[model samples]
Target: MSTFLNLLVYGLADGAILALAALGFVLIYKATSVINFAQGEFLLVGAYMFYTAFVVLGLPLVAAVLVGVVVATLIGVLVERFILRPMIGEDPISIIMVTIGLSMLLKALVQMFYGTSPKSQPAILPRSSVEFLGATVPLNRLLVILIAAVVLTAFTIFFRRSRHGIAMRAVADDQQAAMTMGISVRRIFALAWVLAAVSALIAGVLLADISAVDQNLAGFGLMVFPVVILGGLDSVPGTIVGGLIIGLLTQFVSGYQDPGLATVVPYVVLVLILLVRPYGLFGETRIERV
Candidate 1:
């Protein structure tokens, strides 16, 4: 029983991280229809930037996070404006290839600047644990969950209430109509990219605390695909719930299944969901008649 509780708590924590990362991915996809393959690289860059500011430059933790987020957001905006915007209305295949190329470029750039070695992040939180539901939970894990909840709630409100958020939604619904209504589709795209970067920075910093920061940090970006698809591409709430489901399912499978089966658990779940729902749990349905 203790072990089960421990796994559940830990799984939830891990899911929180995954969900945060997926939130950025979903935001970019929803607003601009651009599948950013470089999303993970943006995260890697932000994490490393935070580490450099906090650890090497001796800046305050809060200040470092702010700077890192700003830098990451700028990087995101520049990439969209210079690289992606130029290819707008081009073949989807061409856009995809360009993003793939950009991802590779960012990876190489990170390696050149940060080197291939991993760096340990300075601990921002004190080492501690608390007992909850008859299980010992790390304070850091609990903090991660709380932070993710706050960020998710804030984003939901932004989309529902804020002017910029409404504009983004309009653009997503129909670019032509949005442009005709005096909304700048280009500006909305830029805004989406910037927001995605800020979200990635937060996730990266939190993740760096849990583990070492290195190139491998970006690989976690791949995990977002399953979470977003499971929850439904455009559903923000679905992203959070789907992330938890995948996180818990992965942990349970790893705990009970043969080692090999554990590795493929996510794919198994994704395949099953795709087969049944096709559009996903909350994905928008499209009806076509010819």
Candidate 2:
């Protein structure tokens, strides 16, 4: 029983991180209808930036995180404006290819500068353990979970209440209609990318805190596809729930069966979900005009 509880706790902690990563992915998709394969690279950049600022430069952790987020957000905006926006009327495959190319290029650049070697992240939170319901949890893990929850909650409120958030939603609904309504669809696209970058920064920081900082950290963005699909591509709450499911399923599979199963389970689930509901759980059901 204690063992099960332990695995569950760990899974929840991991799910929180995945959810943060997926949030950015979802935001970009919802607003611009672009599946950003380069999303993970943005995360890598933020983590590396944090490492450079906090560890190498010996700046405060908060300051480092802030700088990383700002820089990453700007990069995101620039990518959309310069790279993605130009390809706007292009085929979906072309856009996807461009994103793939961007990911490869950015990753290679990072490897050239930071090298393929992983770097240890300075502990942002205290190195302490907390006992929760008979399970020992690390303070940093608890912090990650707490921060993820807070960020999700704040964003949810913003989407529901804020004008910019509503504008984003309008743009997502129909770009043409939104433009007719005087909501600059282009601006919304840029905003989505910027927000996506910010989310990546947060996820990168949490990931670095939990493990070593490295180029591989961006791979989490790829892993998050299952979570996004499970939650419903367009549904924010679906992303959170999907992330939790994937996290717990992977943990249980590895803990109870074999470690290899942890990685495979998410793929199995993704395939099944896609087969049954191609649009996703929260995805809008398309209507045929004919």
Candidate 3:
């Protein structure tokens, strides 16, 4: 039916953005074994950065994007070098606390600078609709899917073939073995943070393009937790699968049931997935002899 098709398109678009955000989370965990509670704030900051550059400073769209990417890269490097670096070798609880604190700090900084009002984002994608399979699909939504797919594909190729990508994978597999192979674990950690930041930045911008830029953008990023958990915390491919499943489910529930119920659906799925398969659909199972 047309209604189902519309929901399908919307769901795919939402899932693409979710995958982008979750991808960064998985990367940092894989490389450094750190659960970055601040990942959402990264998206928040990135969105605002793009808004400031494009709207406030009147920069061209491409220039604004570049500026956002540069700032994101710096934030990642600084966090890895100054904040997270010192906590290396510390207790996992301590690291988690630090990240949680970082998230608050980043959110506070954004609030101080921008306040809580939602800003009108410049339209990057055309605000139009097209008929597809008897369903009216927003042109922007279709563009979002295309863009996300391209970016994800590019990353997949990089990971499978590039030297640095292989090194990153090597480090993720076993830090000690990677070190013995002459890979700098520290460098890989930094790279992971940088990539994560960039991916979050793209997701933030796309989200803001679809919706208004607001504080709630960070909250939306928190949805990544359920996504990565569903897909597999350390599984790169899991992010995509999990994202699509969650995205489609949310849209369908919102369309057929109460919109309010949609908000709770993801968490419910999260709990069920945890009970059924704690390792996630694509997550690896580790068995250690005690």
**Judged by lDDT, which candidate is best?**
3
* Per-residue lDDT over 1-290 for candidate 3, one digit per residue giving the tens place of the 0 to 100 score: 98898899999999999999999999999989999999899999999999999999999999999999999999999999999999999999999999999999999999999999999876999999998987888999999999999999888888999999999999999999999999999999999999999999999999999988999889988999999999999999999999999999999999999889999999999999999999999997785899
Per-residue CA lDDT of model 2 for 93-180, tens digit only, reads 9999999999898888889989999997667877788888887867777787789999989889989999999999989888889889
Per-residue lDDT over 79-142 for candidate 1, one digit per residue giving the tens place of the 0 to 100 score: 8889989998898888889988987998898899889999877688656988888878788878
Better of 2 and 3 by TM-score: 3
Instruction: Tell me the TM-score of model 3.
Output: 0.97
- What is the alpha-carbon lDDT of model 2 when measured against the actual structure? 0.85
Candidate 2 global TM-score: 0.95
On TM-score, the leading prediction is 3
lDDT of 2 at 75: 86
Worst 10 residues of 1 by lDDT: 254-263
In candidate 1, which residue ranges exceed 4 Å CA deviation? 258-260, 287-290
If candidate 2 were superposed on the true structure by all CA atoms, what would the RMSD be? 1.7
Off by over 4 Å in 2: 287-290
Candidate 3: Cα lDDT at 6: 87
